[model samples]
Target: MSSEPTHQNIHTFDQATALQPAGPHHWKGQPGRLYWNMVGPFGGTTAATLLHAVLLHPERIGEPAALTVNYAAPLADLPFVLEARPLRTNRSSQHWLLLMTQVDTEGQTITVASGTAVTALRRGTWAGSELPHPPVTPAENLSPRPPTAGLAWSERYDLRLLDGDLPTAWDGAHADDSLTRLWIQDLPPRPIDFLSLAAMSDMFYPRIWRRRALRTPAGTVSMTVYFHADQAALAAAGSGPLLGEARGQEYRHGFFDQRAQLWSADGTIMTTTHQLVYFRD
Candidate 1:
């Protein structure tokens, strides 16, 4: 159990209707179930909110390398709050804990999800050599449009689809289920940080599931994110916006597979992701 001055300080609130991540994001009343649109905890739930506690502090060093997330449950329409606490802080590395819960008018905290992360400080390997050279649109020529369909987060990033159909997640184009290319750069340069890459990786979820029923939404039990390599380093080398080819789809088995290549600007295969997705549709 790592201890800090504000280790127990949990900032919780109902995420607003828009699922916005600012002051007081909570639920409304009635049928419960968070809202018509609630933020997916993974991508939207960047450990930043949790790290804010420490990164805001003066003595923190290095960036996080590993982050793990597990769904606590379906959040309903109620007052909710989330906070990150440091579980362990040592000389070479750190571990952080995350929790989000629902609170009622009577002031009760129902635990939603608990997550952990391991971060370290060290220069990464691979200096942009040995990776595949992906096509580049350059920030100047990249034109990302708002996702008039699908989830809210998709619209925020100007994504240029490498092969998927249009500004919707439910496109009926399962012919090849090819590699997707999106010009993923934050507004005015959020700068290449660990947080941004984590968020982008979440976008690959729906893309991986664009099979079986491209025109429908699939029920996801719970998805996990594993950061195997550095996306920024790969991007700077211009290897990606790479290709994440959908490898398999088994509707009868309630699963799918997405195999992607993390190439470098010079055309080196940096890393690979073989994602498995489940659907109830």
Candidate 2:
């Protein structure tokens, strides 16, 4: 961890909602507030922060094509260090490795997360999406989802649940299917960017919680995302809500796999993501 002191720039509350850059290859996570989850900081924000570290790096090239983040351990509420390095660079693509660690007062560094991201330059090529957009209530037609009592992170996004029930331990009717479709955007409306979209990819609740009627302890172990669009695409999206769908594929040995897709207002595929989660019954 770089001993560089924290930078003095004061980011807007919304912009720095997840992380603030302290120096080169380093950042300070936001303090306790709406960003908090039941345990530590939300995985979405942590993922975005890792990507953000890459985005801010001067040595980065092209745009993000893929990202995979492994949650090695839970993070504390204190400031943490983010380190990003370009592992390899090809003619049209670049590969990066990232690590987020927390240093104790005694100067012991504990890694909280590690990730890999691929950025590549894209040329005009034939492209198409085989999957049709899932039919669901339009953002304008649905009511705003109310935030849960203790989950302050829920308030950060305006989520309109169009299908599949939210995971509640006592709700048996929706336990069998872990599917969910919603229109989501950051609260108060912030421009769509790689940082925001990374967080949005993880906006869905854990699959185990949605599939089982009982709420057992659950969290993501690793998450991966592939960006289908570039910066211009995200910029065009502005702060508009994007349609999101997520579901579980399998469950065994206290772990399950979940995958999700994000679509723009015009049905353009923006991103696809997958994750493995751990749960205790």
Using TM-score as the measure, the top candidate is 2
**Worst 10-residue stretch by lDDT in candidate 2?**
1-10
The model with the greatest lDDT is 2
Candidate 1 residue lDDT tens string, 192-239: 344444444445545434443354454334334444455455456431
Candidate 1 stretches with Cα past 4 Å from truth are 1-42, 45-61, 74-79, 88-91, 104-108, 124-131, 136-139, 149-151, 166-178, 219-252, 255-276
Q: Global CA lDDT of candidate 1, please?
A: 0.44
What C-alpha lDDT values do all the predictions have?
Answer: 0.44, 0.80
lDDT digits (tens) for residues 39-101 of candidate 2:
887888888888887887787788889999999988777777788889898999999998888
The C-alpha local distance difference test score for the whole of candidate 2 amounts to 0.80
In angstroms, give how far residue 131 of model 2 lies from its true place: 2.1
How close is every model to the real structure, measured as TM-score? Answer: 0.60, 0.89
Q: Candidate 2, which segments miss by more than 4 Å at Cα?
A: 1-32, 104-107, 167-174
